[model samples]
Target: MEKKQFLYMLKLVPELLDEKNWTERETAIIGEHFCALEKLIEEDKLIMAGRTQNKDDTTFGIAILQVDTEEEARYLMENDPAVAKKVMTAELFPYKVALYNPRFTI
Candidate 1:
Protein backbone atom coordinates (compact mmCIF):
# COMPACT_ATOMS: atom_id res chain seq x y z
CA MET A 1 0.00 0.00 0.00
CA GLU A 2 3.01 2.31 -0.22
CA LYS A 3 1.97 3.55 -3.71
CA LYS A 4 4.99 4.60 -5.71
CA GLN A 5 4.92 5.01 -9.47
CA PHE A 6 7.67 4.91 -12.07
CA LEU A 7 8.08 5.51 -15.76
CA TYR A 8 9.83 2.57 -17.41
CA MET A 9 11.57 3.20 -20.67
CA LEU A 10 12.28 -0.11 -22.40
CA LYS A 11 14.85 0.14 -25.11
CA LEU A 12 14.96 -2.67 -27.67
CA VAL A 13 17.85 -3.50 -29.88
CA PRO A 14 18.11 -1.81 -33.24
CA GLU A 15 18.92 -4.90 -35.24
CA LEU A 16 15.57 -6.34 -36.19
CA LEU A 17 15.67 -10.09 -36.42
CA ASP A 18 13.62 -12.54 -38.37
CA GLU A 19 11.14 -14.78 -36.59
CA LYS A 20 13.67 -17.59 -36.54
CA ASN A 21 16.48 -15.39 -35.33
CA TRP A 22 14.33 -14.17 -32.44
CA THR A 23 14.51 -17.62 -30.87
CA GLU A 24 11.47 -19.21 -29.27
CA ARG A 25 13.24 -19.98 -26.03
CA GLU A 26 14.15 -16.36 -25.46
CA THR A 27 10.73 -15.09 -26.44
CA ALA A 28 9.06 -17.65 -24.20
CA ILE A 29 11.13 -16.57 -21.25
CA ILE A 30 10.22 -12.92 -21.80
CA GLY A 31 6.58 -13.86 -22.24
CA GLU A 32 6.66 -15.77 -18.97
CA HIS A 33 7.89 -12.70 -17.15
CA PHE A 34 5.19 -10.58 -18.72
CA CYS A 35 2.57 -13.10 -17.65
CA ALA A 36 3.78 -12.97 -14.07
CA LEU A 37 3.72 -9.18 -14.16
CA GLU A 38 0.15 -9.27 -15.41
CA LYS A 39 -0.83 -11.36 -12.44
CA LEU A 40 0.85 -8.95 -10.07
CA ILE A 41 -1.17 -6.11 -11.58
CA GLU A 42 -4.38 -8.06 -11.13
CA GLU A 43 -3.54 -8.59 -7.48
CA ASP A 44 -2.88 -4.88 -6.92
CA LYS A 45 0.78 -5.54 -6.28
CA LEU A 46 1.28 -3.50 -9.42
CA ILE A 47 -1.31 -0.79 -9.93
CA MET A 48 -0.88 -0.50 -13.65
CA ALA A 49 1.42 -1.00 -16.66
CA GLY A 50 1.39 0.59 -20.07
CA ARG A 51 3.37 -0.02 -23.22
CA THR A 52 2.88 0.87 -26.85
CA GLN A 53 3.57 -0.36 -30.39
CA ASN A 54 7.15 -0.22 -31.60
CA LYS A 55 7.48 3.24 -33.05
CA ASP A 56 10.78 4.51 -31.70
CA ASP A 57 12.61 1.84 -33.72
CA THR A 58 15.03 0.98 -30.95
CA THR A 59 12.47 1.11 -28.18
CA PHE A 60 10.52 -2.09 -27.76
CA GLY A 61 8.03 -0.36 -25.52
CA ILE A 62 7.56 1.78 -22.42
CA ALA A 63 5.53 1.20 -19.28
CA ILE A 64 4.16 2.89 -16.18
CA LEU A 65 3.89 0.91 -12.99
CA GLN A 66 2.82 1.60 -9.43
CA VAL A 67 4.45 -0.68 -6.91
CA ASP A 68 4.88 -0.85 -3.16
CA THR A 69 8.37 0.54 -2.88
CA GLU A 70 11.53 1.54 -4.74
CA GLU A 71 13.23 -1.73 -3.80
CA GLU A 72 10.50 -3.90 -5.30
CA ALA A 73 10.50 -1.78 -8.43
CA ARG A 74 14.23 -2.09 -8.88
CA TYR A 75 14.02 -5.81 -8.24
CA LEU A 76 11.57 -6.24 -11.11
CA MET A 77 13.77 -4.27 -13.47
CA GLU A 78 16.93 -6.15 -12.54
CA ASN A 79 15.23 -9.49 -13.13
CA ASP A 80 13.62 -8.65 -16.46
CA PRO A 81 14.20 -11.00 -19.39
CA ALA A 82 15.27 -8.12 -21.59
CA VAL A 83 18.16 -7.49 -19.22
CA ALA A 84 18.97 -11.20 -19.02
CA LYS A 85 19.22 -11.49 -22.79
CA LYS A 86 20.93 -8.11 -23.11
CA VAL A 87 18.65 -7.43 -26.07
CA MET A 88 16.98 -4.51 -24.37
CA THR A 89 17.67 -1.89 -21.74
CA ALA A 90 15.37 -0.57 -19.06
CA GLU A 91 15.68 2.85 -17.45
CA LEU A 92 13.35 3.77 -14.66
CA PHE A 93 12.47 7.28 -13.53
CA PRO A 94 10.30 8.30 -10.65
CA TYR A 95 7.08 10.01 -11.63
CA LYS A 96 3.98 11.43 -10.04
CA VAL A 97 1.02 9.95 -11.89
CA ALA A 98 -1.56 12.47 -12.97
CA LEU A 99 -4.89 10.82 -12.30
CA TYR A 100 -8.52 11.83 -12.71
CA ASN A 101 -7.98 14.71 -15.01
CA PRO A 102 -11.31 15.79 -16.41
CA ARG A 103 -9.63 17.49 -19.35
CA PHE A 104 -8.15 14.33 -20.90
CA THR A 105 -11.54 12.61 -21.09
CA ILE A 106 -10.59 9.84 -18.72
Candidate 2:
Protein backbone atom coordinates (compact mmCIF):
# COMPACT_ATOMS: atom_id res chain seq x y z
CA MET A 1 0.00 0.00 0.00
CA GLU A 2 1.09 3.53 -0.66
CA LYS A 3 1.70 5.78 2.30
CA LYS A 4 -0.25 9.01 2.86
CA GLN A 5 0.89 12.11 4.67
CA PHE A 6 -0.71 13.25 7.91
CA LEU A 7 -0.06 15.68 10.71
CA TYR A 8 -1.00 15.84 14.36
CA MET A 9 -1.16 19.12 16.24
CA LEU A 10 -0.39 18.94 19.94
CA LYS A 11 -1.33 21.43 22.62
CA LEU A 12 0.25 21.27 26.04
CA VAL A 13 -1.98 21.15 29.07
CA PRO A 14 -2.10 24.57 30.66
CA GLU A 15 -0.70 23.34 33.93
CA LEU A 16 2.42 22.12 32.19
CA LEU A 17 3.37 25.66 31.27
CA ASP A 18 4.21 26.28 34.90
CA GLU A 19 7.49 24.59 35.74
CA LYS A 20 6.40 24.23 39.35
CA ASN A 21 3.74 21.76 38.26
CA TRP A 22 6.18 19.36 36.66
CA THR A 23 6.45 16.08 38.49
CA GLU A 24 8.97 13.30 37.87
CA ARG A 25 6.27 11.29 36.12
CA GLU A 26 5.31 14.16 33.89
CA THR A 27 8.93 14.79 33.04
CA ALA A 28 9.44 11.12 32.25
CA ILE A 29 6.48 11.01 29.94
CA ILE A 30 7.87 13.97 28.00
CA GLY A 31 11.16 12.19 27.64
CA GLU A 32 9.31 9.16 26.37
CA HIS A 33 7.51 11.37 23.89
CA PHE A 34 10.79 12.51 22.41
CA CYS A 35 12.06 8.94 22.26
CA ALA A 36 8.91 7.80 20.49
CA LEU A 37 9.22 10.50 17.86
CA GLU A 38 12.86 9.66 17.40
CA LYS A 39 11.93 6.02 16.84
CA LEU A 40 9.40 7.10 14.22
CA ILE A 41 12.02 9.12 12.44
CA GLU A 42 14.31 6.09 12.36
CA GLU A 43 11.45 4.06 10.92
CA ASP A 44 11.01 6.65 8.19
CA LYS A 45 7.43 7.20 9.28
CA LEU A 46 8.00 10.77 10.46
CA ILE A 47 8.84 13.65 8.18
CA MET A 48 9.32 16.29 10.82
CA ALA A 49 8.25 17.30 14.32
CA GLY A 50 8.59 20.67 15.99
CA ARG A 51 6.91 23.30 18.12
CA THR A 52 6.65 27.04 18.57
CA GLN A 53 9.05 28.80 20.90
CA ASN A 54 6.29 30.77 22.61
CA LYS A 55 5.33 29.84 26.14
CA ASP A 56 1.66 30.70 25.96
CA ASP A 57 -1.80 29.45 25.11
CA THR A 58 -0.98 29.87 21.44
CA THR A 59 1.86 27.39 21.61
CA PHE A 60 1.58 24.10 19.75
CA GLY A 61 3.65 21.27 18.26
CA ILE A 62 3.18 19.37 15.05
CA ALA A 63 4.35 15.97 13.88
CA ILE A 64 4.23 15.16 10.22
CA LEU A 65 4.03 11.50 9.31
CA GLN A 66 3.66 9.19 6.37
CA VAL A 67 1.68 6.05 6.92
CA ASP A 68 -0.38 3.51 5.02
CA THR A 69 -3.86 4.59 6.17
CA GLU A 70 -5.84 7.04 8.19
CA GLU A 71 -6.22 4.46 10.91
CA GLU A 72 -2.45 4.18 11.21
CA ALA A 73 -2.17 7.95 11.33
CA ARG A 74 -4.75 8.21 14.05
CA TYR A 75 -3.14 5.40 15.95
CA LEU A 76 0.25 7.08 15.91
CA MET A 77 -1.22 10.34 17.13
CA GLU A 78 -3.22 8.75 19.93
CA ASN A 79 -0.29 6.63 20.98
CA ASP A 80 2.09 9.54 21.30
CA PRO A 81 3.36 9.45 24.88
CA ALA A 82 2.33 13.02 25.66
CA VAL A 83 -1.17 12.48 24.31
CA ALA A 84 -1.65 9.06 25.91
CA LYS A 85 -0.59 10.36 29.29
CA LYS A 86 -2.69 13.56 29.00
CA VAL A 87 0.28 15.89 29.12
CA MET A 88 -0.88 17.07 25.74
CA THR A 89 -3.95 16.86 23.56
CA ALA A 90 -3.73 16.10 19.88
CA GLU A 91 -5.81 16.36 16.73
CA LEU A 92 -4.98 14.60 13.51
CA PHE A 93 -5.35 15.92 9.99
CA PRO A 94 -4.63 14.70 6.51
CA TYR A 95 -1.78 16.74 5.07
CA LYS A 96 0.22 17.33 1.96
CA VAL A 97 3.72 18.64 1.62
CA ALA A 98 3.39 21.03 -1.27
CA LEU A 99 6.97 22.15 -1.20
CA TYR A 100 10.21 21.35 0.48
CA ASN A 101 13.39 23.23 1.26
CA PRO A 102 16.28 20.82 1.15
CA ARG A 103 18.38 23.04 3.34
CA PHE A 104 15.93 23.20 6.18
CA THR A 105 16.85 21.42 9.43
CA ILE A 106 15.03 20.99 12.68
Candidate 3:
Protein backbone atom coordinates (compact mmCIF):
# COMPACT_ATOMS: atom_id res chain seq x y z
CA MET A 1 0.00 0.00 0.00
CA GLU A 2 1.04 3.59 -0.59
CA LYS A 3 0.83 6.47 1.82
CA LYS A 4 -1.17 9.65 1.16
CA GLN A 5 0.45 13.05 1.23
CA PHE A 6 -0.15 16.75 0.70
CA LEU A 7 1.70 19.96 -0.01
CA TYR A 8 1.33 22.94 2.27
CA MET A 9 2.28 26.51 1.44
CA LEU A 10 3.25 28.65 4.39
CA LYS A 11 3.30 32.35 3.77
CA LEU A 12 5.25 34.63 6.05
CA VAL A 13 3.10 37.33 7.53
CA PRO A 14 4.23 40.25 5.40
CA GLU A 15 3.72 42.69 8.21
CA LEU A 16 5.84 40.61 10.53
CA LEU A 17 8.74 40.36 8.13
CA ASP A 18 10.87 43.44 7.72
CA GLU A 19 11.95 43.90 4.13
CA LYS A 20 15.43 44.91 5.33
CA ASN A 21 15.78 43.16 8.67
CA TRP A 22 14.16 41.22 11.47
CA THR A 23 13.90 42.45 15.05
CA GLU A 24 15.54 40.44 17.82
CA ARG A 25 12.11 39.27 18.89
CA GLU A 26 11.13 38.29 15.37
CA THR A 27 14.40 36.40 14.95
CA ALA A 28 13.77 34.43 18.10
CA ILE A 29 10.25 33.52 17.04
CA ILE A 30 11.44 32.50 13.60
CA GLY A 31 14.13 30.42 15.24
CA GLU A 32 11.49 28.58 17.22
CA HIS A 33 9.53 27.99 14.03
CA PHE A 34 12.60 26.53 12.35
CA CYS A 35 13.25 24.32 15.33
CA ALA A 36 9.70 23.04 15.17
CA LEU A 37 10.07 22.18 11.51
CA GLU A 38 13.35 20.48 12.21
CA LYS A 39 11.58 18.29 14.69
CA LEU A 40 9.06 17.31 12.04
CA ILE A 41 11.85 16.57 9.59
CA GLU A 42 13.56 14.34 12.12
CA GLU A 43 10.30 12.54 12.70
CA ASP A 44 9.89 11.93 8.95
CA LYS A 45 6.58 13.80 8.90
CA LEU A 46 7.96 16.46 6.61
CA ILE A 47 9.59 15.49 3.34
CA MET A 48 11.14 18.80 2.34
CA ALA A 49 10.85 22.34 3.64
CA GLY A 50 12.35 25.56 2.37
CA ARG A 51 11.71 29.21 1.70
CA THR A 52 11.59 31.24 -1.47
CA GLN A 53 14.57 33.52 -2.20
CA ASN A 54 12.68 36.18 -4.15
CA LYS A 55 13.68 38.79 -1.55
CA ASP A 56 10.43 40.52 -2.29
CA ASP A 57 7.13 40.87 -0.44
CA THR A 58 5.89 37.68 -2.08
CA THR A 59 8.51 35.48 -0.50
CA PHE A 60 7.20 32.56 1.57
CA GLY A 61 7.97 29.05 2.77
CA ILE A 62 6.99 25.64 1.38
CA ALA A 63 6.71 22.25 2.92
CA ILE A 64 5.93 18.90 1.32
CA LEU A 65 4.58 16.34 3.73
CA GLN A 66 3.33 12.76 3.88
CA VAL A 67 0.29 12.65 6.03
CA ASP A 68 -3.03 10.83 6.20
CA THR A 69 -5.32 13.73 5.37
CA GLU A 70 -5.74 17.44 4.95
CA GLU A 71 -6.99 17.70 8.52
CA GLU A 72 -3.80 16.14 9.77
CA ALA A 73 -1.76 18.55 7.69
CA ARG A 74 -3.73 21.47 9.05
CA TYR A 75 -3.18 20.21 12.54
CA LEU A 76 0.56 20.22 11.99
CA MET A 77 0.51 23.69 10.45
CA GLU A 78 -1.67 25.08 13.21
CA ASN A 79 0.77 23.81 15.79
CA ASP A 80 3.76 25.50 14.19
CA PRO A 81 4.93 28.31 16.47
CA ALA A 82 5.02 30.64 13.50
CA VAL A 83 1.38 30.05 12.68
CA ALA A 84 0.18 29.80 16.24
CA LYS A 85 1.90 33.06 17.03
CA LYS A 86 0.60 34.83 13.91
CA VAL A 87 4.05 35.17 12.39
CA MET A 88 2.80 33.24 9.35
CA THR A 89 -0.29 31.82 7.70
CA ALA A 90 -0.76 28.78 5.49
CA GLU A 91 -2.73 27.45 2.52
CA LEU A 92 -3.03 23.75 1.97
CA PHE A 93 -3.28 21.91 -1.33
CA PRO A 94 -3.17 18.44 -2.82
CA TYR A 95 0.08 17.74 -4.67
CA LYS A 96 1.56 15.06 -6.83
CA VAL A 97 5.29 14.82 -7.45
CA ALA A 98 5.75 14.15 -11.14
CA LEU A 99 9.52 13.89 -11.01
CA TYR A 100 12.24 13.60 -8.40
CA ASN A 101 15.54 11.90 -7.60
CA PRO A 102 14.86 8.22 -6.96
CA ARG A 103 16.85 8.29 -3.74
CA PHE A 104 14.48 10.87 -2.30
CA THR A 105 11.30 8.98 -3.11
CA ILE A 106 9.23 7.52 -0.31
lDDT of 2 by residue, 1-106 (tens): 7789999999999999878899999999999999999999999999999999998789999999999999999999999999999999999999999999999665
**Model 1 TM-score relative to the real fold:** 0.70
Better of 1 and 2 by TM-score: 2
Indicate the residue-level lDDT of 20 in model 2.
Answer: 87
State the weakest 10-residue window (summed lDDT) of model 1: 12-21
- How far out, in Å, is residue 61 in model 2? 0.3
Candidate 2's displacement at residue 104, Å, is 2.5
Alpha-carbon local distance difference test for all models = 0.67, 0.95, 0.80
Instruction: Name the top TM-score candidate.
Output: 2
Superposed by TM-score, candidate 3 places the C-alpha of residue 72 at a distance from the truth, in angstroms, of: 1.0
Count: clashes, candidate 3: 0
lDDT of 3 by residue, 17-58 (tens): 665556777778889989988998898888788998886678
Rank ordering of all candidates by TM-score, starting from the highest: 2, 3, 1
RMSD of 2: 1.0
Q: Candidate 3 overall Cα lDDT vs. reference?
A: 0.80
Clashing pairs in 3: none
Question: Model 1, which residues run further than 4 Å from truth?
Answer: 16-20, 55-58, 100-106
Alpha carbon lDDT at 72, candidate 3:
81
